[model samples]
Target: MLNIMELQQILPQEYPFLLIDRVLELDEGKRIVAIKNVTANEHFFVGHFPGLPVMPGVLILEAMAQTAIVLYAKTKHVDKNMVRYYFAKAEIKFKAPVVPGDVLQIEVEAEKMLSTGGILKAVASVEGKTVAESVIGFSVKNIREDKT
Candidate 1:
């Protein structure tokens, strides 16, 4: 159970880039459930479309990736103080359109763990309708003490 502020502290993303709004459920090394409140006021709506604003499909996938990254970070014991999860790859399919004023429910289930990263299955839904789903991959990298 984590709120936006709490999530920000744990997740590296900030402001507009941080996609997930709240973490509803988390089972270490298993699954995670999160939510993102898409609003008409979002910055993307201005450029994506002026008359009919639509939440970009890529953003939906990013939301799922964020959800899975957080799950991996928490479960793998990757020290947040020293490590960050990098967006490696994603195989996703979109079933419906997500629009402004929709609360996206993102659910991720851990499928496999690699030596340097892991894979996860994620889904985003709106009002019981599946909007998007994906198999996401991410890698953990520790902060470099010296960058030369």
Candidate 2:
């Protein structure tokens, strides 16, 4: 089990943008199970819908991607300073709406890897119900120099 602080050390994500809360299980680059606490205070709820707020499908995918990043970091043995990940492809299926106060269970598994890219499949669930699933391709490269 990886706590929030431990996960923080493995990934370069910060508050508001940090989607993963805790890692329940990990196999050092092969697979991971993580959790995200969805709350009413999430900024997206303000515009996503005024009254019937549902967590955006895109954001759920983002949470999955964030979990994948942790798996990649652990598997590649690359420190946060050395590498950055970009989303190359994502095929997502959203099966249900995620509301506030739900605990999302995110699971990611590495499907394959080569020198330049890798594929990961992930699923998000609430109360044992699958909410979304995605197969994401990621490419790793050095952090870009242009911040501006």
Give per-residue CA lDDT, model 1, range 1-148, as digits (tens): 9899878877777889899999999998899999999998998899888798989999898889888877887787666677767777889999998889899999999898764788899989999999998988877766784232
Give the local distance difference test score of model 1: 0.86
Model 2 deviation from native, Cα RMSD in Å:
2.1
The C-alpha lDDT values of all candidates are 0.86, 0.88
Q: Per-residue CA lDDT of candidate 2, range 105-146, in tens?
A: 999999986545589999999999999999999888766642
Count: clashes, candidate 1: 0
Q: What's model 2's lDDT at 110?
A: 92
Assess the local accuracy of residue 48 in candidate 2 as a C-alpha lDDT between 0 and 100: 86
